[model samples]
Target: MTGPVPENGQHHDLVARLVAVLRATGGTAAVCTACHAVIPTVDGVGLTLFTTHARFVLGATGPLIEQIEDLQISLDQGPCLHAVHHRAPVLVDDLTPTDPRWPAFASHARRRGVAAMFAFPVLLDDHPVAVLDLCRTTAGPLSDTDRRQATVYAAAAAVLLRADADADHGDGAVVSASAARTQQATGMVMHQAGIDAAAALHRLRTHAFDQNQDLAQVVTDVLTRRLRFDPTPG
Candidate 1:
């Protein structure tokens, strides 16, 4: 299992193995736990599901993974978000402070001992429905076989999450209170500044970092009408 799977049959077998485990476990949390056990190269895993309205952190292997997800949520950038946007895997063998893709996220994650990251988009009906994120304490590329397994795990996660969504009418992916508030503030900023979602979120992140305030507090200020984003001049 150190190199490429070498054959399509082997790859399908890997997917079946994980899909079985996912079905037996019957939940996103169990999917993450199982993925962590099987993917030895990764130190932590997080799963995020995106619906029409919002995204949810449906599962995480531990606190480190949860913290990484939170950082991405606040900054509005990271491998997980990128994977979802590109509908493909985003693999970083080393996360360094100078990485231009996500400078702030890379710096903070490196300080937290996350030396590597891999994010795979989970697809259902050819549409990306979620991202499966892996974090490693050591900086190195994943073995080809391990990377294949990660892809399979992400496929299995999509199955489990889709089932969960169907059962609860998608309400199971409850946006956290902070996340809901952040979304509200982002909408407010969008209306005020005549900008899109991405720009509004970036503005919120900038204000939070500049003021040395927590993102939630910044959102609170926006929601309370204490802070506003004025439309920039053309």
Candidate 2:
């Protein structure tokens, strides 16, 4: 995720450009853009757990974004979930006073001090895939200008994600379903050779769990000859 810092002049120039875009469009402070992977480049495929391509966060909205993600994983429902499932934007203007559409989410969000939320789907070839979220602390519908700005950001995110995905796939950096199946088949072959799938899975999981590393990284190690597994004697 780390990269060379931009020269002061270049840094200021970029910030100024963003500020000009936001100001001309009347956007509020606290704007941020994020891609799915830790590294924004296309080569970091399968390195992170981003289901969506990229997202934009604004103002005090960052904390709420984490809270909402946790809530969705806990309560198993919410706008982000819908955005991912149905591939469409989910907008909630007010969290207080209850909204019939998301009774559980509203109650939980209100308790957590969230007032408004918006999620826009990122699309590829007219098919929605990822989500871009925007939020506000104060309770009220998003102003027209804010909505426009959010949409613009979402559009930019969609373009970036599409380009990244395309590049990764084209360069063989991204894993495909067939590749995953092949890897699984290879693993099964090793297991059938008496490697022990459960034990191996456990060992891998244990190593990753103890190291606080990603499961995918563990798998990569196994595939890349960096790690080896030996079955215990029964």
Candidate 3:
């Protein structure tokens, strides 16, 4: 017996094929290419049913996804973030009632009606470049078959994202997916510190206004633990 092999053509084709399989299986899934940014693909369209059921639209969904990614980048905690960073899969059976590992995220997810989620990292050369995610409204684990399918899909998605990045940059230039993850982790940390994210944004804006520091640097400091938010005023 031969294992399933990818057909020729850039990675996106493989992703499309995998997504077709998922939809055939009647599961809700989404593919995020090139640093977990949701790509507009066939499989992606099928997965949007879940988001639509949750009331996400193009105008709103983009920011929501960005917020979720940023939370992981800023707080340095989140299944998706870890999955991408470690080039592995991370699954949460439930998000309601809070999980100690990601209290903020869990709470927010629960509020948004996300009961369960699975994040799989798509990697190349031990570096994660994209993610494949699945979710269910019930608090149950994915079956073995589903997990296997997700793994295959993630690998294919990574390849596709890389190809897209290559094409976008032209001439073999490459961008590090980790850079996006780092930015998200940095935002997550400040959010976890009980500092209002909006306020942190204000501080970031002030820093950008007063000093010539890059907003990314300020975010990095917050995430790396170099910057602390003081509750009491001096």
TM-score of each candidate? 0.70, 0.47, 0.47
Residue-pair clashes per candidate: 0, 0, 11
Q: On a 0 to 1 TM-score scale, where does candidate 1 land against the true structure?
A: 0.70
Q: Candidate 3, residue 5: CA error in Å?
A: 14
Cα error of candidate 3 at position 229, Å? 23
What shift in Å separates residue 211 of candidate 3 from its native position after superposition?
Answer: 26
For model 1, residues 1-234, the per-residue Cα lDDT tens digits are 246453778766767777776667655657677778878778998887776655556677776886687678667689988998889899999899778988988888888789999999999887888888999999999888678778888877777667767788443443434455767898999999999876787788778667756666788899999998899899
lDDT of model 3 at residue 152? 64
lDDT of 2 by residue, 17-91 (tens): 654564444232212322222112111111101243222111122334544543443444566657767776677
Which segments of model 3 are wrong by more than 4 Å? 1-76, 170-234
lDDT by candidate, in order shown: 0.78, 0.48, 0.48
Quick one: how many clashes does candidate 2 have? 0
What TM-score should be assigned to candidate 3? 0.47
- CA shift at 117, candidate 2, in angstroms? 1.0
| lDDT at 125, model 2 | 71
